[model samples]
Target: MRKINKYILILAAGVCFTGCTKFDDDINTNPNKPAKVSGTQLIANSEMYLPGIANNAYGSLYPQYLANTTYIDDARYTTVNFNFYSLYYGPLMNLESVINSKTLDGNEGPVENQVAVAKILKAYFFWHLTDRWGDLPYSQALKGSENLNPAYDKQEQIYDNLFLLLDEANATLTNSTGAIKNDIVYGGASLSWKKFANTIHMLMALRLSKVNENKAKTEFNKALNAGIIDNNAANFVYKHLAEETNENYWYTSYTRQGRNWYALSKPLVDLMQGTADPRLATYADKNAKGNYVGLAYGLSDAVKVEEYSLLGSNLRKQTSPVYLVTYAQALFAKAEAAKAGWIPGGDAAAETNYKQAIEASVRQWNNNDVTGLDNFLTQPEVAYTAAEGTRKIATQRWVHLFLNGYESWSEWRRTGFPVLAPAPNNNNKQIPRREGYPTQERLNNTNNYNQAVSSFPYGGSDNLDARVWWDNPNK
Candidate 1:
């Protein structure tokens, strides 16, 4: 009996030792570094990627808003392909995680709202991608190891899916309550997001104008009726904070590093100066001579930096705001729609929208100061003429879209306005219409890449000169 009792005691001691080992493991684990990030955290990660477009100096060179002072390769269109790998691996993947997350972010917001925002952002990223690269892995994308080598989807098909995703998001937000947590863009305001989604919807519809006018008109009208961003107060801007992590890219370049590589292009300066556009005060800074002189874009020889105006002081500040889509953009879209007969009231309404768009843009850039606006509007070149309405609106829209490179570049491709001349020493001898597919696509997804290249519309080839589907009016 004594031996059996001793054996039982030894067994109990062994069990206690094993349990204590497990407890020690639990206590040593780091609580701050979560095993799985919450949906809110993932969405915040996605928002961090918005500044890429705003700070794209290369993209700005394409539209002639920025001139390369010493290095002019990009301005001369030397680079043919731009990698979008970071976009997919970073923001897009993070948003996809939120969409697939089974656990709700309780008190942060309803699961529906969280998922809806993710879907909206996902659609936006895809929209930006397709505009730059015509065909992409849409349906099969973000599948992780499930589909390692995904086939590239046609741009047309991708557009269809984007529309569906946006629609689903808008509808899902209707019944959802509570502000989304970690929402840096709209600060958890669900209504603002709804308006922003519709604004994107309208803009996408307009892209189809040249290729599919009927469809474009129908979609544009639908989005307009559904409610888009109509006022400056609700403009979508990426507000950079006064911290290292969120400081404006210009601040890092000019202030921190003392680099002055970019200057306002002659084309932009001449246009603004010609019309005495009031926004020029805020878009550029005076040179050493106290004059707003611009640099000749894509110059092969280096010029004296101080002879030309650099970026405005406001633009280079640590916390300078980057406007994404603004009320001015929405108004310009409406003005174009009206002029195209997509909306009611015709040219008369078009004129009204055009004037309002300029006013809004002027107010936005000049800190609501309209000191020289009235006179500037009456200038012959600045006045709205129904006969030249299309060219007029396109030109003004380009002016208002200063520094927002991708959108301006896309607009130049679509409208053929402002009459940009190819750089004198350009490699292609013409402004590139589209970027070539990344080299990784050819190496890793050979079959799919070959198929996409061969299927290019309007006899397009996989080159910088080749036009995307929407850019091909002949198609």
Candidate 2:
């Protein structure tokens, strides 16, 4: 019995000692560092935030002018008060961190492919920044916390840099190899990246056409030679997963919270309705009485509630892809280039390409099924006639870009297609040229903001709608 008791005591002491050792280790040892994140993870977070940015671009400032859409009045009223500067600064700032940070995992650094993706994304954000605010910080913008008061670069210089960055991205896409994890769009497919890079090149060239014809033509030719998106399958898009967390950017704004905030504008609806466009059915929904309805561009509170029809469920619950660039847009760009005699193609060829581009955009919206589109193409209003100029091509492009308000707004600023009436109650009775610097700029970077505003053609006032450097009539 004594022997047994002694053995048991020994076993208990050993157990106690082990437990004490573990407790000591837990109390005194540094906590395990979190698993190092990857460049792909950083990219994923950046991609995830894009929809919100896009939503704010269209919904807040450039509200739809259609009759059945919602928030026409509210959008106009709030535009002056909304803080859009954050939209430009926030995402780009975060992405800058990911771009500069050497190792996502603190051990394994970013690869060539990761760097290429980051550069492309950076260019995209800068494109929006320049388009919206004219001149903004470029080379010095994303130095993380180290350069908080970076000086603004001219829009012309920014465009030059965009071309350079895009060239680098194209080269990287062509050469980089191995699987790219967290590539939610293309699954790290090099071919798709190449196509997207070329598409962006084409877009940038067209954007610069008004300012730098020679450079625009050179880039345009380069993009065409490199190749563009072949079809909807190769489109650059970010798909939403249908859950609230992954829901479309304006889903809540159009649905539960606002209820009936936006409706189609009269001009847009008239264009679709007058031409008997099939996309109207796909884009909008029938009301309780089965009638299609839209809202006026600027509505006052005194307006009757029944006058504003809610947007159809088609748009409200739309799970279709959100486009970054499409083959149709490339075709339209080709048509525009051809119309300007920048390309070897003549009017007939340009018309053919324009028609194809229009068809491509329509087909993309219709799930890439080209079945009935051919018949629709026979209609004179819907078809491309050889006599038409850049206006025709641009008009069709605008229609295809419907629901993609930021792209539409940008296109309008670029081409002035689908001519819209001035806002009835525009504060300055002038169209907004660009969003103002955020009020926070006064607090955070007052000197820089003051310098930028002082250089503006219209006294750099917030209300001026003067075209940006690249958008003005020069080239």
Question: In candidate 1, what are the lDDT values of residues 1-475, reduced to their tens digit?
Answer: 1122111111111123354557776677665544444676678778878988668887788899989888777788888888988998898998998888876556667778888899999998888888888889888989888987889998888888988898899888853477877777887788898899999999999998888899888878877888899888899888887777678999999899998989999999999999999999899999999999989888987778899999998999998989988999999999999998998989999999999999999999999998899998898888888998888999999999998888888888999988999888765468888888898888988999899999887667787788788996663
Error of 1 at 84 (Å): 0.5
The C-alpha lDDT values of all candidates are: 0.85, 0.67
C-alpha lDDT of candidate 2 relative to the true structure: 0.67
Clash counts for the predictions, in order: 0, 22
Q: TM-scores of the models, in the given order?
A: 0.92, 0.85
Runs in model 1 deviating more than 4 A are 1-37
Best by TM-score: 1
Look at candidate 1 and tell me the lDDT of residue 126: 88
**Can you write out model 2's per-residue Cα lDDT over 1-475, one digit (the tens) per residue?**
1121111111111123353556675565543433343666556656665665455534333635343234454445345423545644565655665567655542322376776776777787777767777777677776757788878777888888988988887786644346566666777676787788888878888887777789899999998899888887888787776556566655766664665655566667667777767677777665556666655666544344445445445555635456767888888888888888889877877888888897887787766666567666766676776665677888888888766666667777778776776667646354455666667777888888777777764344743355577667443
